[model samples]
Target: MTQTKKNQQPQPAAQPKPGSAFAYAPAPESRSVVDIAPSYGLFIDGEFSDAADGRVFKTVSPSSEEVLSEVAQAGEADVDRAVRAARKAFASWSALPGSERAKYLFRIARIVQERSRELAVLESLDNGKPIRETRDADLPLVAAHFFYYAGWADKLAHAGFGPAPRPLGVAGQVIPWNFPLLMLAWKIAPALATGNTVVLKPAETTPLSALFFADICRQAGLPKGVVNILPGYGDAGAALVAHEGVDKVAFTGSTAVGKQIARTVAGGSKKLTLELGGKGANIVFDDAPIDQAVEGIVNGIFFNQGQVCCAGSRLLVQESVADEVLDALKRRLSTLRVGDPLDKNTDIGAINSAEQLARITALAEAGEAEGAERWSPACELPSAGYWFAPTLFTGVTQAHRVAREEIFGPVLSVLTFRTPAEAVEKANNTPYGLSAGIWTEKGSRILSVANQLRAGVVWANTFNKFDPTSPFGGYKESGFGREGGRHGLEAYLDV
Candidate 1:
């Protein structure tokens, strides 16, 4: 991942000179737009209530370590209460006509769009991602998912699943911290669109947006208990998954936890879908556009501070053009601005939490200890928050820990291949098969390599591009089941 800034062209006069008075000013998004409550409770049965045990936890802004708010910590008793509410609501919710359900979904989608800016700001404050990403990427997709599934509510009969598919009773869903509201939209939109009720537990670190979404549901006039939000840690998620009233279980998190959930539901009647971890490979052939490939490489791994499940953490480049790609990548990394999450100019933000920062630091250290050459730009970070510089490791091999493990941070491991066969072999060597990217000018080569890859989703000439109409999931250790498009509808329907 190390690259030299040599042989680069000089900037034109129109561009701001280094250390000049013409340098850009701070253009920060106003935090005044988001009004945070002093404390919050769980959203159950269309009402807010404290956890049965009265346990509470505080959420902090990762950017400045500021206390955002205190949220109720759900326990087993709370899980039981939420599940019971969902079970009670299932009868009428499922009995509603598809056309009527579509109206509710469409209303939710419209409200999401109307309040998207407020939600996006809250997401950045709670999730520690750049405001640009929360505003442009996460918020837009959240609305699109609701709208997409809203269109499918009345069309399930023509979706080829069956003439009349019945709704699963209740879904117990657990989403990770990486994409809070977007993941909620993914799990809840389909479940509700197919006439199933949901009791969802958002990741502990990021819960504000989901709580706000419960407000959106109320504004949409969605029926009571059709969607329940429980903000808590792992214990609450475990309780929800093991609840007997839940007929379906959906989880999006680490692979180890996904395995645990699978074991818990094994031999039971509960239908399950798990979207887990990935160490996706972004392959660059000699014939690919060097500049375009470098941008894609940055966007794939650096977007969201590399916290994405389907991040292109591994870089597999053809040996013939490796030097060119690495040099260009290095030059590009040097220009990235890493700082304030609210700053529109900031390219990289704080890590989600101190724990995640330590994990990333340890893994990067392991890469250096295991003989991978590490390099990072000379970037100064803010003193108060958890932060890590965008890092790169050159001379990485499939055997190296950095290449094999999911770092889930702003780190990229670079590897090289001599031929197409070697590229495919190296890409498929990973146990996780969530995603892979192919960068090449030749359509034939893109099709050929994509066909041979083991990943469930393959991107050609692009990376990290998502659509609500496109199905997304993983294979093997990355987990099973799709979460988007028409295929996503099947997870909630009983044919």
Candidate 2:
């Protein structure tokens, strides 16, 4: 482990009393459960095949910088092939009885549950997120999404879109590296439930889980060409989006790329939905419970190394309680563990890539340059692997880039507000409005403040919470269209 800079160093932990059992034993999750192949090919027409140009890329583990596998890099030709396959399968897949489709979805969900442990470990390895999070959060949500959409398979008529909702034929999906499997489930499950065939592209860094999912699809006896997984970079994603055979496009990525995708599909018959970037505000009120609010604040920004699209990167505290909240929040951050993604006890882990770590370091430096006071817990990062400390910036204003831009890191910008109106104003000051968190004990205040917030999803007294039955998206530059619940189905259906 390497020490951080002296000025930004975290305070050392107090020594445990001798012979006391207060210290935690290392409990690293074994990595043997996940078996990586030497090389992987694109899953097209229900079979693995080399890219047309025979190009490939290596996906490395962010935690150890180990090359996990070599995966096919899809090109324009590969994208066209996938779209053609999906187009060919659409008639048969959309013609299937809705209940029959439900059975296939249900089978996939059950298999996901049975292999949950394996998938969780693999995700932790490939994505560099803590095992605790993969085991507890991502995998369960993936399965739940499948099950939730399966239940709606035969019941789309009752979903209120129309008396009879129609499938959109083919869906082209692009998911980000963060929460790779969960994002894939979010895009794929609903499309299949609504009887649309899919050509999905996983982020280049985290393509393993999607390939694993293709195997699951085959195990469930899904028809050939119903689901195709293309592992590639932005060029392939562009090709997929521009393919004429695709009737719908769903993308979860950066706001910049989402805009490009929107333009590519614009003036065409393709339906489009984008779940993009965010700078969510977690507002702490004077009346909120201090300890609970601190935990919520920590979870909001620090979970997944703050790689989340809807992470609460901005913190707004009432002037009356700002001092108390800051003290408690800093103290809590000091105890968080920040190493070894496979460790069951790890609270923070590596950033997803060296490129991402560089971006985070640059932005955090910019925050300091802009005169925001920066602080981080006294945590040692590993000598190898990409890592960034959980950071906080005090004395931030809406004008500060740290408070305004999507840093997309474990860095929070603290701003103080005098009243509820001020808090709402500061929270809604950004162009992105994907989500927001409000901490208060009063129910009426929760309802009143929530109604005024411009974000797509607002939570009272909780942060970063998600459910399959709830709709989630954003207002403004965060991107349009929801991705869960009955609302999610609407994106894949023609009413």
Candidate 3:
């Protein structure tokens, strides 16, 4: 029974095993279904046109470093044209009966469903997320978001804000890259449902899907100049947000950028809403279900490779079950398959870009430098891609950069808490208030803890579950304003 006795018992030959060191067969999804054009132009005033200065930039696949297409870059002049178009269309668009606008949104949602497979494949190809995620999570949510907002279009009169809220004309929206098309849906759907016209700029790295969305707008027979798409870098976004023609500015990206946009729109008449970053905490109590809690932790941080704004990057586990939970987590991580994103079986895919990958690497290295015990499962990344192994940091302190900053990658920081009060305090310590999760068997404790977590969203037993009917936003520096449901209408309306 002792260590000496156990060491003397097992002696086996070193031989080839069945499942040890197994390699996944290459099962790449066909790109033939997706037809990437050689070049693309700005979608302004319901037509594709060149940049004012004819400047163009190339977009590449982060996974293979292959150039996907050349897209026209928009400058101040192009932004002006798009804004003018949206403004010109706003009068009629907003004046239309809510029923007509609702019908258009309903049509868009139906078309998105009909073309879900094509859109999913295109999103997976343009962004670095796995095909499974694009097909299952992102695309379905995109459609549902449109569908949910469509119903709200005709019902805004009875909403609590006021008897009759007026639409904010010519909304300027900027979206991030993590959930490209989904973010587009989130921004544009609410704006349109409120009868506002939009001039949106998709992230430069992931613009193809948004341009495809422009095609959807045309197919839906959305009025000319009602929706405009501009694909460009930050300068174009700056121009769009600062243009006097824009009455509302909606942005979803970094906290720094959000701050800058806030400053730019300060003292102006433009209304703004920002959905920014987070360092979400997944707290596991002593009396929690260990197995289910472990699964929640994994889904919390590892979904979308932890590129989520509300990812549970910080794990606050009770010291009693810390060892058990971490051991099980490490074992479960070892089974995760990471490789080509096109592979349906791949669990983790490429990083979104070289710059983001570098940021993640630097932050992770800082974690090790700050004396946290860094660990990653034994996994092989492809030679020709941007990939980071699923990582966990144990012995992490409150002051550690990884624990405090938004690493925004497939990295989890594990910290221990002695009591529920300490867990709530540690979770609330961060400036971000996007989301948090609590795992416990006690019903009263879930309510007690959820009430004090200082986050916009709280999940008692599960993690990362989203529904279109639920309004989502954050507090503090994580940014403000709701994105879904009845409350979302306030941002785009004169409530």
Candidate 4:
């Protein structure tokens, strides 16, 4: 989207009931409505209930800085209760045939399809992602995840994990704010399909979507206590991670936090899977199609406002084609429309929160201070929202903050390399090894680079594309374990 100055504030709006889904389509005039929610409660035992402590936290809309909802602040006690609920349910839930669990996931997937628009609006409002992506990419992939995993439910006998691989009881899942609903499905579908119960903690900033998911679970007639949703900040997540009752811990967030969680749950009886952060590289070779490469580059770093952990933040362009690619990128960037997330025409939406906005702004300044030339498209940011323009830094050195750090905004750092070895070196320079993109015409070059790349996922001539059948996650500091496809089921299985 466009860039806001950081101090802008939008007017307040009315709120909806907590755990209710918001439908913003089929309107007479406008295609969207700004929805707010009141008194969000934790989903425990398949029912919505307030936290025992009565503590709540405001979840603000990044698009307008408006308070969207006040969600339950689940503490250690709440986590324990939820885990107990899950544990109690696991006896029967896990004992049931895998086909039965598949049916539940199938019903949930259908409900997601039926309510996709409502879910998309709420997702956009809460996560500050463009509605186009929320509706098209995030929601569909969420449904697809369940659909893909549902078949595995009945066919687990032949899943190669052996016929008797049982579910790890009471999976404690903590998802990041970037792709809230999608990540929820990524973590939850496999856990449930494999006959495990889930106690999930959605990211603090994007709790609304997960709460909506809980509502979907209720609508789908899922068994009580099979899936619990507790919304709060890092403390709530920490509680879930360290709880003794939890059989496993699965988290998707920054590497810094992943390390802490890894250390906390170390040597414990709990199984853990972490899908952490990344500073991925998108390399453009001289032999690639200039126009297609431009689009790929734009999509690599700018999709979801670059909040993606797999965002191609580092651009390694062949020195010979650098100027041509940069020129096309500027023109391509100009066409991106950053505005109200609900607007069908809007391309870039708001940052997820004020704090994220500050983080992005601080890093942009650091790029400037480091002598990198910053270029932004001509676009008007929202007058009262957390917005940041798609920014690119030229003349970026490997040591530049924008090059090395995860800005988690629509900002890209451009660097040139003369050889494949140099490009590989720059691509692997980061501690995070989540994903990378290679755009070249030569198949041999693509294969060579893909093999040499340290990332878990490498897109050839494409970028940021995902599929339910494809396993995703990272290697090294980006965190361990995969999240989608058959490989993801391994994390929840007691092999």
Candidate 5:
């Protein structure tokens, strides 16, 4: 393992016990003017109610480490109730005229727009994305996703689906923390539009926005029980996927969990879609524009603190242009402002939680110990929050742990290739096949390499671009199924 300067502590269990004082948690703060209700419960049958077991968990803010709210901790019984409600509603909701369904979706989209700032602020607070990206990129795209799929609700007959396409009974969706409300929109809009009801579980670390979404459903006058939001830990998610009443399971998270989900759902009648991890390769050819490529590389890995599943963590530069690209990359990275998510000038935000920060710190240390040269801008990280400066490791070989694993932080690993074939070989070296980027002036080369790549999404000289009209997902261990465009509707449709 490469030893990072930040991770040289003795193992906790190995350390001698020290006389310590009483433990105290951070004090909770007054609620933000954000319209959150006290004592949130599971949304079932279009109503919010306590969990069957009456268990609850505290959701905290990554920025200030403040307790934001207490949310229902769902278990098997709650999962069963949610599934039943969705199953019952699916019949009527799906049976409604397609135009009516489209109208419901359109109403939801308008409501989202009306409360865009609130949703974006809440998302940034809960998930720790920069306020700028959450407001400008994530939330808007989330609303747009609904609008795009809204138009398709009445047009499924014209979609590639065969004649008389039908809705799956009930869909259980599990999304990750990196892109909370956006992921919910990705899952729910398409599912509901195709006429399926949804039992959506947002990541435990970032459930606030989804619960807010449940409120939006009420405001939009969506039929009772058509959409439900459950906030809980992993066991709750497991129960949702294994429930026999659910007609489909759609998930976005790590590959290991995705594999387990696949195993759990195997041989079942329920359909499954997984958008798992990615160690995306951002390649820069010698003839590519150096300044633009540097910007692309920064946006690729540094956006969302590199917590994104589609984050381009690997940089494959042609050997001839490697030095120039690295130089420009360093200069560009130096200028990135990292701090409070609420600050309009902040460039990067906090790591989603203490646990995630620990994982990223451990992996970064391993890279240094394994002989990869690590670098970071001289920017000061905030002391009270979970922060990791955007980082890079040069002289990185494919064998290094940092090169192979998904650090899921703002860390980049740069590797050199002699030719385009070598670039492709190194780019596809990891198990993940989510997304990849190519930077070059040569049009034919872009198409040639893109065709040969195994990833589901390919960006030519662009990074982290999203639109409602484009299908997005991953290949191989990155998980299965698509999330956007017309193709996304397939997951909810019965053959």
Candidate 6:
């Protein structure tokens, strides 16, 4: 009969019994690899120096509430000192050949790559994001940012602004705690590449990585005073923003603070850019690939435990398949492991602080009080540190506070639309215009929806993707000024 035998698929691997026998063994990364000192001094004029007033604050690991180190608290006087140092360094730093600057940047990028493992471990320990994310996303992006801007250092003349572009005098930068090193990269890389010296402020809770970066500056033999780092609370940041010597200012934090900086620098000669908050919308159509969409939904909201400014906190599903997607997403959420940030298998980690956790709880409570359906996966959180179970409110509407506010935690507000036009309208109803996501099988629809979106960044068929080469910022109240790519260079140059 000449019939061919049917091809057989490989058999599944055997699974162990459901008990300690099948449990994943603890594979925590060694904490000793990172040398967190008992206390750290401010990085001023390229050297570690105490605050002028001898004031210092403690920084602790959010995961364990363990004290990491004491950091110098910069006051108004320290901010002035840092600004003057930057201004003085600006002359020589600006006069250096673009090629010379490129060398320094390239050296810094290589050092970052070499010490990436140590930095990754430190980031996880301090930031409460999983080691997997720090290793896979943050470190690579940080190194790439320096490398990307390094190429731009010598090539600015040909960047199409003009044949000759001049540098801004001194850039004052303040980065948030969410992605400390990456935000620092976004601020420092282009500023340095464009021939400006910088005075940077690490958030109060997270200052160790930026302090380590000062050591990198020394390793590169970067000129003294070219890069100054101040680790302190909001008063220090406010003072830096108010400093008269700084020619340019860049900040990434909450919208409230961004608005305050805008008001503080209003009518001044200083150039400013603020990358602020978001309530991104992740929309799924009936024809979307359901499995991939579910994964994107989880990643968009739950990544970094939803600490990201551009996290997709709002989910819009087409009514035709809304129930199907919700069912699938809830099932997927149950599979996620949430616990120790150092665990290689952990999908979610601790909330950044008790204050942030309380905010999340209050907003979640509001969702339930306003008659929305509140649901969370049954997961155990460590009692020692701040934690919030990943949650979703399925009955949210545009009128609800949960749908309007930026929770800045791992909480999703689900809304449904019957058509693409309605989805677009509902998504744009919010005051935020930071980022959005759309998933559909139709190519033309992707283009159409994206064109209608007011957000600065949009993703189709994917979520939470970033590149050093792409420009990132927001529209409306989400704040302004692009932070990456060729556009970012313009913010630092006087063309």
Please state the error at residue 138 of candidate 4 in Å: 0.6
Worst 10 residues of 1 by lDDT: 1-10
The segments of candidate 6 whose C-alpha lies over 4 angstroms from its true place after superposition are 1-23
Please write out the lDDT profile of model 4 over residues 29-117, one tens digit for every residue: 12343234566789999888889899999988788888767888898889999999999999999998888888999999999999898
Deviation from native of the Cα of residue 39 in model 2, angstroms: 0.6
| lDDT (tens digit, per residue) of candidate 2 on 256-334 | 9999998888899999998999999999999999999999999999999999999999999999999999999999998
Candidate 5 vs 6: which has more lDDT:
6
For residues 426-464, could you state the per-residue lDDT of candidate 5 as single tens digits?
Answer: 998889899999999999999999998889999998999
TM-score per candidate, in order? Answer: 0.96, 0.96, 0.95, 0.93, 0.93, 0.96
lDDT of every model, 2 decimals: 0.93, 0.93, 0.91, 0.88, 0.89, 0.91
Clashing residue pairs in candidate 5 (N, C-alpha, C atoms within 3 angstroms): 1-370, 2-366, 2-368, 2-369, 2-370, 3-368, 3-369, 4-365
> Judged by TM-score relative to the true structure, which candidate is superior, 1 or 4?
1
lDDT of 2 at 345: 78
Q: Which stretches of candidate 5 lie over 4 Å from their true place?
A: 1-33
Q: What's the count of clashing pairs in each model shown?
A: 1, 1, 0, 2, 8, 0
Query: Under the 3 Å rule for N, CA and C atoms, how many clashes does model 5 have?
Result: 8
